[model samples]
Target: MTVVIETRDLGKTYRETVALADVTLSLEKDTIYGLLGRNGAGKSTLMSIITAQNFASTGEVRVFGEDPYENAAVLGRMCFVRESQKYPDDFKPGQAFAAARMFFPNWDQDLADDLVKAFLLPMNRRIKKLSRGQLSAVGVIIGLAARAEITFFDEPYLGLDAVARQIFYDRLLEDYAEHPRTIVLSSHLIDEVANLLEHVIVLDQGRVLIDASADDLRGRAVTVVGDASAVSGFTSGREVLHTESLGRVTSATVLGTIDAAERDRLTAAGLDIAPVSLQQLVVRLTQKEEVR
Candidate 1:
């Protein structure tokens, strides 16, 4: 239950636009966290600030119980891998891995070499000449091999094919099991990594919309479908997230757990209750908070 990263009233702004606002979050140690949000929802900005690659306009952040800015002692234990990670124009995958091996204290050369082969990276070719997927592969290889205590990957699977994406997921899980660490993965491919996440933090329009464990989020919302009258009656006085109606049929999504008594009542009302998918819940939660 030790906290690895924590922020208080964190805010980041650019001229007239605010990228992050009054964000307070606590990330526990040795757990996989999914930092999910739509594009422009401040996921990357938050990651950059936490990694000390960018400065926050206001508020404070602590990594490993100390300030991270220019603190090599703390920064050395963290790695931030993103699609925008640039290498010298002439540097190749092999060169990048060699450099990472020197920077990260826990770098695993064997893992790096195996990943290079699995990714089929052209070690001889310049990084600038690689395709998008190839470039993404380079980032993934470095991320896994770095073995930092805290690693943040911001959409590092940009152009990977389904097969390559699966490989990344497989390797990440395999490695994490053997050497547990705090990992924050920010990706738009929600359903793909939904099961991999132990906890999820969702941002919407510069605000933290949802932060909860995967298990708790699973039952945080439920959808019921049936006759319009029955569905309406069942969801009344409850926190309805989303609702749709077609003729006399209606389906409504409500936020809150339905315990035994509520479940029995719903069953008696002839309403069929279905569990909500994580993707569906996030889509509803960050979807402008539609009025039912």
Candidate 2:
């Protein structure tokens, strides 16, 4: 696979405020990437810069081996879906779909039509007259139907109900299986998207904090539960992220690869070993970054 996008020492500033800094990163072709971070952590800013919606104060960005700044070749193959998708006040859902069809090279009217019915969106109604959930459906429909080679979804499930959100996930997976493309999803719904993402890039305080395969990140930490003394002895020199105790029993979440030998030793000490969720790992990692 080829590198779909790359950034070198990317930095952005607004007067005295730094929105992004020293952020060198790469995204590969035909992969699902989660741009996870807290608010004001540069997820949106980075996306804006890459899509040429904003400029960087320093560094460079390349999309499909060329600059994306007002470049029609690059922009035409990219689709950016966000909660705040805007249109003229008098524009209707039908008009929005028409415009997307004309703009995107790989637009799929069949898929768009199916999505419209699936989401129960009103075609003739003005976009401004639609409910929040209905409005989100319009963006989701365009994002999926456009079939852009590089798709960026920034919190696209804003007002969707549980069922509607699941529908979006199911459709995305179904379509992606048939048409592989590079996708960057910036979202705060960590645990929900953990299973969908093939790679993870965690940002903190306007810098890259964690970048690794989802499987590797899953194994980066482990939780151990056992007697307080035994747990203490086992984790004596390790980095303990979080700990809890009740009477003589204690549970500790620690960072590092717990090997087979260590697992056996933990079992021998009557300790239970468990896998750490991606959400928990991200939370701990960001908290640690804050402390530093």
Best by TM-score: 2
Local lDDT at 264 for model 1: 91
Candidate 2: 10-residue stretch with minimal lDDT: 283-292
The C-alpha local distance difference test score for the whole of candidate 1 amounts to: 0.92
TM-score between model 2 and native: 0.96
The lDDT values for all models are 0.92, 0.93
Q: Which stretches of candidate 2 lie above 4 Å from their native place?
A: none
Q: Which residues of candidate 1, in runs, are more than 4 Å off?
A: 288-292
TM-score of each: 0.96, 0.96
Give the Cα error of residue 205 in candidate 1, in Å. Answer: 1.3
